[model samples]
Target: MSAKTIVVGNFKGGVGKTKVAVMASWELAHEMNKKVLLIDMDPQANATTLIARSAGITEIESSIFESFENSDLSKSVLNVKENLDLIPAAVSFKNLPKFLYGKFSDDIDQVSYLKTLLEPLKKNYDYIFIDVPPTISDYSDNAMMAADYVLIILQAQELSLEGAETYISYLQFMIDEYNAYIQVAGVLPVLLRPGGRVDHATVERAKELFGEDNVFENYIKHLERLKAWDITGITYKDHHDNRAHQIFIEVVQEMLDKIEHFEGGEVNGE
Candidate 1:
């Protein structure tokens, strides 16, 4: 089977996109024993920092933008662990938009540049996850056009729900204008406060907007360990918190199920 590329993205910031991208890729690699390649498409590189910290990597030598400009993807790849690999990001990636502008004219397939770069390595892994920035830019568009599926991360809040819709709309725009072949895996709700009325309403609104099946059943609840990971650069395993660990496990299982189901249906001509 070819690698299934899932881009974790949102149109707004601070809604746990990197958290879901990092933890989901970690669980898939460590627990499920799958070969996973995580590309840090965002210039902020939070996902890169989290994965790099876990592996004791202090500095990244090459950023993913090198693949776009130089046509050598191997320069950016780093073996982070047994089953996990990374193409880390750097602050210099912020200059990619300007560089891309010079490479692609109005008639060129600008958005498909990443897809072309990643095509040669499609069969190297079981999964490839890309972490995109919050806004829709040249980088995020490259990620979107490169993905087989898009996993949108949302929080249990009104503004986040709206952000989820905005991202879905952007996906539609890409499909319509650029002829990108991609689908939404699902909308994952994070930071769930179970007992709060606002949280309940937000969940219901998500179901109503995206359909019950389109939104994942397992929601990632807020936990102190997750918050601490950002500061101390610790992992879910380092904390020994079953609550947070199990939540990530369930999410990985759900993600696996969706991908298998989607891919199988595609193969059988469903």
Candidate 2:
């Protein structure tokens, strides 16, 4: 089965991009029993740290950079759980741009290198989720080039909204310039506060800008448990943890629905 590769990102930092990517991958693998692979494209390695904690790994032996350098990502795969796997990132991944330029003469080859490398492994999983840094760089370019869909994270602020818009614009640029076959999955809102004035106004503005249907109905409310997961490594120890997990489960279900709709030839933002 060919996996549906999705890149979760935003052009603004602190918009919960890595959190959404990690939790969504966790829910899909741990909760729904799906074979999932999470590829951390961010050099910060936040996703790597959390998943490593979950797997009880104190030190990273390998990273995606090694896979890229070796031209075989399978060699770097680390099993996080029963159905979950991860290709961790390293700070050394910042050298990717230089490596790409040194390896390929054409810009297309540079941008699409990750896609070429990932194609062979697509048949091994149900889904492949990529978490990239919040910027327009080699990391994001490679991730976008390799993905079938991009899930934009909107954190319910004016700057975040602008970042989402800029991200969509860049996605379109990728499609038009390099012929990357990808689509915007949908905008998932991460609220600063549930029912707060800024949160309400931001979401309304997002719906108007991105179209009502293009914005997810189920949003992520600010939760202490989510913050705790950064340190505790995604535990489900209490009622609050279950509640937070349930919220992502709903979001993921909706994401699947949107993907199905897109596959059926439904136009986005319609």
lDDT of 2 by residue, 1-270 (tens): 788999997898888899899999999998887889999999999999988886788877899999999999998898888989999999999999999999999999999999999999988888899999988998999999999999988877454478888898898899999999988899998865545434677788888888888899888888878888888888878899999999999999899899988788532223
The digit string of per-residue lDDT tens for model 1 on 1-270 reads: 578899987888887888899888888888888888998988888999888888888877788877667977777899999889998988888988787778888623677778888888877888899998888898889998999998878777554477788888888888889888888898888873434233777778888887777788887777777777777665545445667777899998887777667667542112
For candidate 1, what is the lDDT?
0.81
* Candidate 2, pairs of clashing residues: none
Alpha carbon lDDT at 249, candidate 2: 98
Output the number of the TM-score-best candidate. Answer: 2
lDDT of each: 0.81, 0.88
Query: Number of clashing pairs, model 1?
Result: 0
In angstroms, the error of model 2 at 225 is: 1.0
Candidate 1, residue 136: CA error in Å? Answer: 1.3
